[model samples]
Target: MPRPLWAGAISFGLVTIPVKIVSATEDHDVHFHRVHLADMGRVRTRKVCELDGEVVPQDESGKGYEIAKDQTVPVTDEELEKMPLPTAKAIEIAAFVDADTIDAVRISDSHYLAADGQVAAKPYTLLRKALERSSKVAVAKFAWHGRERLGLLRIREGAIVLHSMKWPDEVRDPQGLAPKVVEVGEEEIEQGLQLADRMTIENLSGFRAEYREVLEDIIAAKADGKPLPSPDEGGERKSGEVVDLMAALNASVKAAKESRGEDHGEEATVHEMRPAKRTGGRTAPAKKKTASSKTAAAKKTTARSTLAAKKRAGTKTAAKKRSAS
Candidate 1:
């Protein structure tokens, strides 16, 4: 079983529920060690004191705050633990707020608050059920690592979860980060919405770290003295420049639908609306002949043939008179 990181009580008005905090998430990243390139020797970093230039051990080191370039205030764990903060030994529930009102940007690390013992079971379950039924999260204040931090407590899978949050002042305003004002067509916006809908999923549980899987394969091949795996072909490379906005959105929606095994029987939400090409004063193609028009063309040909036959007969008559003379 994973060990508890901290043990504290939730001070909910008149009720106190003892709980233990454990990490709600774990990292599965592939770690690497520094090594010398010439002989592949492992290289390690050592902590050395600046003043004496001697290596320092982990247990001998302590936390210090630098007030100035050369002035630092050393603080010990005992002093921090014994500080007279109200939340030093308990998570003080300040108020309850609707869960939707909590800004995702302010939230950070999370921990699971488990009932510490049988004595804490009833109150812990009560708080969990209250949060679940009320559909609200508890805004709380707690001290960890020698400083007070804002927290949000809510129920997760029948257990209480404490999410560390930044204070309102700690979150920076995003006034300058946005782009300049520009107009977007309604069709483009609608197509973007369609794309979002096509890409939506119920949960993120289906995803995995494909990069780490490939990395592990590479390491295993190297360790076994075998040939390294070749890169997969036909991978789509993302491009920065978009020549046509509507065309890109249409393509994205189609691709997303195809990825999810959805049928594109109906046309996409928007088509690429392109301007009509200029003719440059060129004449257009003649229209196809209708039945009445074909009859009129045949009559004109017959009249021309009759006129040629009459001219030939008149020439023959003139030739006969000349011969007689």
Candidate 2:
């Protein structure tokens, strides 16, 4: 097993359990290093003092808080270590609340809480079982690294997991960017819901990041001294003003059904009233056909007119020849 990142005791009322925290997730993103174009040498950075033109060693450097425009107050590591915090070596449960009450956006990072030793295993199991039975999460506070953090403790997959939470102020206010209230018809709302239902999936395991895969392939090709692949030009999409909302929703539902190998016998009837089209300033009126569709209809009409003219000329020629005979 991998070594735990932190060792601490979890306390609640009169119960205490010695537990170790381990990271519950990992990053699989591809990383690159900066190199010189001429010699391919790895580029390195150094910390230098801004006030004095001198290279600062890692050991000599310490954290500081800027108090003024150009002045900062230096804080020593020893002083930070001596600061009083209840969670430095222990996680104290402050409250127990329904798990669903916590907003998913507030949850930040996750870690697994495991029993530190065999002596603590019983209490750890009891706490996990109790949390599972109550269907609630324990809100706890702890200090990790240099800052104190608020977290939630809950049972997951037969193990206790701790999730760090962001403060209420940390979440940005979305009101400024949110869309204004707009009227929507019942049929449009129903069709929109149907479209969403068609696209819903029970498991997200099948979804993979194709962009990352392509990036990795490009890197591999470069390493092997092979020719680079061209980037893909994705299909174009129509603007909201030109797009028939009901038609598009119906098409999406049909496509999704076809992708799942389900037989969609007949297309759903699109109601006349469409969902509001969002332009910059106001909702634009919906059109019967898009520009491309209008162009196609004009071409078809011209073709039919030309065909009718040719048929009339052929009949007139035949009549003239018969009269001459």
* Per-prediction TM-score: 0.78, 0.77
TM-score of 1: 0.78
Where does model 1 exceed 4 Å of error? 235-239, 263-325
Q: For model 2, what is the alpha-carbon lDDT of residue 260?
A: 52
Candidate 2 residues 211-280, lDDT tens each? 6556665665675586766776895685555876767776776666556545347554433223333467
Q: Highest lDDT, which number?
A: 1
Q: Return the lDDT, model 2, position 205.
A: 88
Q: What TM value does model 2 have?
A: 0.77
lDDT, residue 92, model 1: 99
Tens digits of per-residue lDDT for model 1, 1-325: 3568899899999999999999998775666789999999999999999999999999999999999999999999999989999899899999999999999999999999989999999999889989999999999999988799999999889889999999999999999899999999886787677567556554779798777666666665676586776887997657765467766677676665545444347554345322222266432222466899899657544544454465568667987887788
